[model samples]
Target: MTSHRYAQWLRDSAFGSLPHPAISIAVTLGYLAALYPGTLPRDTTITAVLTTVFSALGACTGRVLARRSRGRPEEQARRIVFGSCLVILGSAVGMAVWWQNLIRSAVDVAPAGVGWCAAATLPAAVVVVAIVAVPRTAAVVAAGALALTAGLLAPADAGADEQRLPVSSSAQHDPGTLLRGELRVGEFDAAAADLARSWTASGGLSARAVVVAVPTGSGWVDSAAVDGFGSRFAGDVRVLTLPYDQVPSWQAFVSDRSGSAESAIAVVSAVATVLDSVPEHERPRVILYGQSLGAVGADAARVWLENEHPSLLDETVLVAPPAGTVALLSRTPRTVLANSSDPVVRWSFAELWRPHGATGDTHVRGPRVPDAPWLPVISFVQTSVDLLGALDGAAGVGHRYGPEQAGPPHPLRN
Candidate 1:
């Protein structure tokens, strides 16, 4: 009887422990999937699916190990559940980190299809793991992480093509309006006609309005200068592209400059110049739009406008502004749109807080406007695909300072 009881105790304990290698390998592969879904061939989607199944099995095996090591049935169940939850949480964090890294890379690499694939699959995989494993605590954690990941990484498809404004036949009449130019900084340019088209399309606005887009990084291309604004605003809008390399004078102005900070100053200065040059009467209700590095540029410009030239800015929009800029700038009346799910923003906050003991709340100092009643529009695109798609499709364009959409416009104040 004594030997049998000892044997049972060993079995329960063994069942409660997880397989370290299995967890390690699954987590590593999951992260890789989050980073480069296209690295696996289309033929390999099945393989990827199978790998996830194996991961689930591995998790179960760990639970079994835990169950075996503990003798009491209730205790065994608790241990199994707890261990599974931890593993899932760890996997989720790993995936989020991987996704952020992938996005930063995709800004330079193309055939962006890979980035899209990764963005779509990472969250789905997390869901599958949660459902299949089904440990109560683990499932809850997996769900939360999945929600957060989807919110961050899934918006990629929405704005992938947002480099230029869409040009219809009407755009041809204005020769001066058809500015075909490009700016080069290091490896990136401020604007491209194709990107502008994508941007216009994403906003659901007619490509025939006065639109102004600012692409900040490396340098702004002529396309960014002319087409981005001219095509949308019908030559009424002036696109001011600020190339990072072209701003030596402004670069000297920022006291302790990081590359991002320099880019911000350059863009703000460029926008200020454009605003100054325009005959106030001809300037269409100016809307400032920025993405990624451009977001930092937009934020900086908004700050400058608020501090130095508040009269010049009519409306402003920033997508995925860097955490540093978000932290530094004061709240303004501009409409700021951000992705709650974006891993880049999240990770940036994590990096910031890890060193400085700050919270994500520190970066929340933007205008409170919601997506409607546009005087100072504040919109938060929920999904990556939707945000990117709106930017690409011209669905996200236009300047309406009133309520026209279905959802309650996110109020600017509160």
Candidate 2:
């Protein structure tokens, strides 16, 4: 009786325990659908069904692994296989949610409010608990989760924000001579000034042009743009990066987004302050960049990029700017880079409100490779591993943007 009770206890805890796993469920399905971006139906009904089935399977697999993990090698093998599936499915769900939200709504993608951040990270936690019966698999899941957590924080970068730069030093800075400098006041203002000074110091800014970059959800400043654009961009252009104090919650994310938007506006304002001190010929031109939630903040500041000043913010370059980004004023030279494979850039359905956008000389939609002929089986297998590519911070043609195998020439500069 005692042995039977112990077995039952193990079975109960392991099985049927993902009662509130919607967050995990969404992420898992989305990642899978992304494998064959063009091949998949991309319908919410399909995703809803997949999420339900995946959740049920997760519950079933967790239980079976828990019950049979202590059995013979064959049973342990089954546990390993099941445990592996759980982690893969969780990522697939994430991909689906990401795709759908990109096509759906930019501002409130993934229901940004209340307990959203916990929902974002909980699936991995759930996986850890479910696979505990298999020590080896458990370790793999835990390690993967830990690595993801690290990438999900401030990405490896070097730049100055308000926390590092101050207003007093603003007068002393020169755009042509600075390398890595400091910050103060609103994060965007301090960083923008730093870039302005760097450009002046380099004495290489082309037409005084610059690319103002906005960080992602984790406040990761994009080094890709800075490295890719190079000096002709500013003679010595400054990739003026804006900082949003990220606190790891939807409210905080949203709050930071609003602040980042306001800060983006303020950055423009700060650049204006510094530029006013210099001659019109010496002032640097400005452009923009953002991704995921960063796109939300950067895009929200689109108005400043438009009217009120002819020379300021000559153009706008938005990467995966999200659903419902307002179309730029007809005259604004803007470029929007999007990927059909990234739900973070293009998921939409009837229940979801996908905002309309502009079609212009600068719009590009792709994943480097043309979508393969629709094959559900192949797509699923492809995206399963592709998500790992996303976790590593980037990819050539999928969700996260990396090297463009082939794309337009000089988008921001043009």
Candidate 3:
């Protein structure tokens, strides 16, 4: 009798219906705790990881039973119900993370609870939609759309409030009109042409010098710098900055950088090719300048600059170059105005990639410049208060090299 009872317990435990609900409930609870954060830790990394693993497990279990689903309605229904609960819980957690971040940014206070269930019915609604939705194709597309939306809506860097500006009319040096976001190459040319014509009318070509400036992430042109160049150099110093290939975000900065660099080469080359056709005396000395991602664009333009027009760009001014800048074109004699405490520019130095080393060091693109006795021409400036500044704002506060930091005669003004 005892042996038979132990055998029965083993069979029940191995093929038990109990495991399904037990795993589901534990996963659901973890997700709930992560998503709700009512009085829990604001840091959601651990819970987010837990919910992700459980959701994946639930999905795998459902898929394993999919082949036999038609034969057993009851079993199929159980798996379906379990998977549905995991997804439902996941949506709740995603929203909670978003909400908690938002409120924290707004009030600058610690949230008391795990997170506010501002919309308590959100999870139920998501589950209902998921159940009724047909064709897994739609779900895949929806998931992609959700990710894109989240990336696009990410918060701007600090001081964004003061930095946000539409590309508009200039005060002193006419930096072409304000650019709209995500422009095609042709559209950019058209805008540049319009601005060039205006610049010519304002005695631009007559001054025999031009400066093309790139704005920050939020499309802010350094009016002060442009204005300063116009006043200090006694030249028209025309400035033309551009918008992004798409909505700006830190995550997609590399793609944005690649696009901006390609565009810069094309637009600047076209403009320069035309200007170079003029008599050497009549041709304006073309200069390049960019801040943040635009600074990145400046660095990337080096590949083409060296390949196509080695001496076309006479000078360059890059302020607060972000991480991943490997500007190898020392031929342009560029000046990097960095805030010593700014992690943005500092990260660029730490971003070492040699021809032989760790996996991250495997950059097969042309020559490795960082180790090449590289004269970065960096002018690092900082103040006492800059120690606490983040990568984005340190340059402005510590180094005082912001858009408004213009007005002084820039080193390239010579």
Candidate 4:
């Protein structure tokens, strides 16, 4: 077709509401794209959610491309569109098989069988059909599906004060006991006071250093980090964490990021108050720690500490901190532990155009996936997909940290 005619088609695709073969093919392509695997293997639930969400989004995208014009394509355009769709779909299918197998092999997981694939794609197909045949109903279904997904992904401990008893009663020998359970939604200060009082009663003030850990959105304190703290400090360190929310991390992140920060500030303030009661020469060092969504709170707490009581804050440790939210530098010593394979640490939109981890910060660790190449839009899509299974990877990879995550805080520079 001539350039003028091609421009006209483009306009029609962008504005017209006509049901074009190209639009349908595009929607199919989107569903197929969602089937391609990322850095980790996915379970059936993740597979269905990913496929359905992407399919619905793809339908909306297709609508935008073919929304305004009701004009039908020419015979030649129709033939060409069909031929192109075959080539594109065949390529996508081949890539889907290869990529899924590659990722599963890398993660040492069993390959998903054909039955699993069919079952996973069924929901996506249904959602796509609804979108094409009944747009309003499809919108409601998509919204509900997303809400259900958020709820399903939340941790078991999300939202309730039912605390998991410590493996041992001794907080020194079993720092995991320091979890202290969660408070209700708006009583972070009260929870902090209670936690501080509990720690003081347990002889926590005698430790060489006290680390206040910030739990993730689901009130999860990493068992690995707790164990590491106990082992590294040789029972001379106190670890304390305050739970802030019961929702999934992403939901909390979008709807109430400041709440996490407020929770951290409350805990830090409470800890600092207790430290003030001890003699200046005998006061224990204070180290702030957080991981993932916890890191968002830790970053905020670090800022509050820097401004309100700089002397009380000795060091900060952030593991797999979300890319955009973390403060890279600190007035006090700080360590940033990030795996190169972790999408949570490197999947910001800025990565679409520039390489990350190039900043001259001493704390930023290098990439673990040395051979992985960064492509413009492709990398973004790959990482976005990877976010779905980030926690499924083994320790020290993706979003999973090992016991080393609780290592001693960064030493101050001379």
- Candidate 1 lDDT tens digits, 1-414: 698897887656534343334343444443333323211112224333433544454555554554565353454555665477557646654554354345334332223355444444554456445533456766677567558756764323222223433323211222444322234344222333333443333331322223244443333332433444443444543343433433321132233224444444444444455446656765445455555555565566567667877776665655545445554434554544433223233323244223212223232322221221111111111121122222221212311111111111342221
For all predicted structures, in order, the TM-scores are 0.38, 0.49, 0.46, 0.68
Cα lDDT listed for each candidate: 0.40, 0.47, 0.48, 0.70
* Clashes by residue pair, model 4: 13-65, 15-67, 15-68, 16-67, 16-68, 16-69, 17-67, 17-68, 17-69, 159-246
Q: How displaced is residue 374 in candidate 4, in Å?
A: 6.8
lDDT of 3 by residue, 79-156 (tens): 776788768776865666565555344324355344334333343334323422332653575577559856874555
Candidate 4 local lDDT, 22-90, one digit each (tens): 566767667666665455566777677766776777778876776765776775675677577657755
**Candidate 1 weakest lDDT stretch, 10 residues:** 398-407
Give the poorly placed runs of model 3, Cα more than 4 Å off.
Answer: 1-154, 157-182, 185-194, 249-255, 348-413
Candidate 2 residue lDDT tens string, 90-203: 564456455444533421223323233234345434543454435457656657755875676433221211123233443233234223323343555666566556545555
Candidate 4 weakest lDDT stretch, 10 residues: 167-176
lDDT of 2 at 110: 37
Model 4 regions lying over 4 Å from their true place: 1-21, 28-37, 43-77, 112-194, 246-251, 277-281, 341-343, 346-387, 408-414
Q: C-alpha displacement of 376 in model 2, angstroms?
A: 18
Q: Write the candidate numbers in order of decreasing TM-score.
A: 4, 2, 3, 1
Q: Residue 122 of model 4: what lDDT?
A: 73
Better-scoring candidate (TM-score), 2 or 4: 4
Clash totals in order: 84, 48, 10, 10
